[model samples]
Target: MPAIGTLVDSFDDNAVDAVLWVDSYGTYSETGGRARVACTDGYSAYASAAAYTLAGSSIYVRVYPPAAGGAATAAYGQVSLLSAVAGTELGVQVNAVSGVLRCQSNVGYWDAAAVEVAYDPVAHAYVRVSEAAGSLVWATSPDGSVWTTRRTLATPGWVTSSTTVQVRLEAHRDSGTADYAEFDNVNTLPASPSGYAARKAGLFLGFF
Candidate 1:
């Protein structure tokens, strides 16, 4: 990645996710110019689950200027979660404000490795799989093939038993919300994918 203040791109495009720099998070200066990682509990705050677990990739940082703010800006960041439930963490978004990359916590939903929407003849619950961002909705039938039309769930920090359940997980961005724009090292969390076979998948099949 380029050095600090190397100018990845201007704040012309609309809000976007993905690491801007391959090896570096750009700088965002609301108050000053100094690269720093800030969070509620530092980096690597994670959640827990009875079935699946939570995990995160290496923290990726990017800077987002006011898009209209004028001044010598050299600030940026990465993103992460808000609450560590020791159970579940939805889509945790992080961003930078004033040179401090703050971690956005409590962004919940059920982020899982694999998600499929199937009819629960027992509970009568129609399932809907989706990403933490609310897009990327995938539905499955009793056969995991033919699917029905279901809506997407975009409610952050929320999961439900409605048509679209919030169990499956995928990476997402919290651009619409404040304090969740860019994350620093806070993006990296404990990966809980290992329990998929025993916890997650088993939990699924168990639901006759």
Candidate 2:
């Protein structure tokens, strides 16, 4: 079968149960219809759920970061694809501290062995990621149509050979200060034809 699965959450449901899992400091009620992750204690916050099992080797999503505000500290919110419940994940994010977009990877809790600085994708930008043909591509767009590739992870370990991973939303704060982020219109839609070269990938599996 071709690689095809869609999980689009407009977050209009106004319920966190719409997702498979709402773990650690992640909530869906604070903003009515968006998934919100807040980490005021200067810790990593995660909001995730099963997205889709890879039928080939391609997956991606378009996410909206929270609008600028709140404590004005160095923080970030991201959308990622995780291979396991607790370890190994890859995705694109925006760092408020550095004022730029980035490609991030995590091996375990509090263990970010890799962090690649990309371009600045100011608040509300359409950020996306796609993996196929042994590569993981990260890009950002002012609009969903025109995109600029920021970074590419070609290493084998960047994305495991395994075909299933969960979609995740994260909020990270620098110091023990109040910071929050909201995600909306999250989906598994490849950035472009070239991004998902091996297969046509785009789908909205379900809210939950």
TM agreement with the true structure for every prediction: 0.19, 0.66
| Local lDDT at 28 for model 1 | 25
User: Local error of candidate 1 at 117, Å?
Assistant: 13
lDDT of 2 by residue, 101-156 (tens): 66665567333544455444452267766666666666666655667776666644
Clashing pairs in 2: 6-203, 6-204, 6-205, 7-204, 7-205, 18-207, 18-208
lDDT of 1 at 90: 32
Provide the overall lDDT of each model, using Cα atoms, as 2-decimal numbers: 0.26, 0.57
Error of 2 at 167 (Å): 1.9
* Tens-place lDDT digits, model 1, residues 81-131: 222244333332211223321222232333433222222332211122334
Model 1 Cα displacement at 86 (Å)?
8.3
Clashes of each: 29, 7
Taking all chains together, the TM-score of candidate 2 against the true structure is 0.66
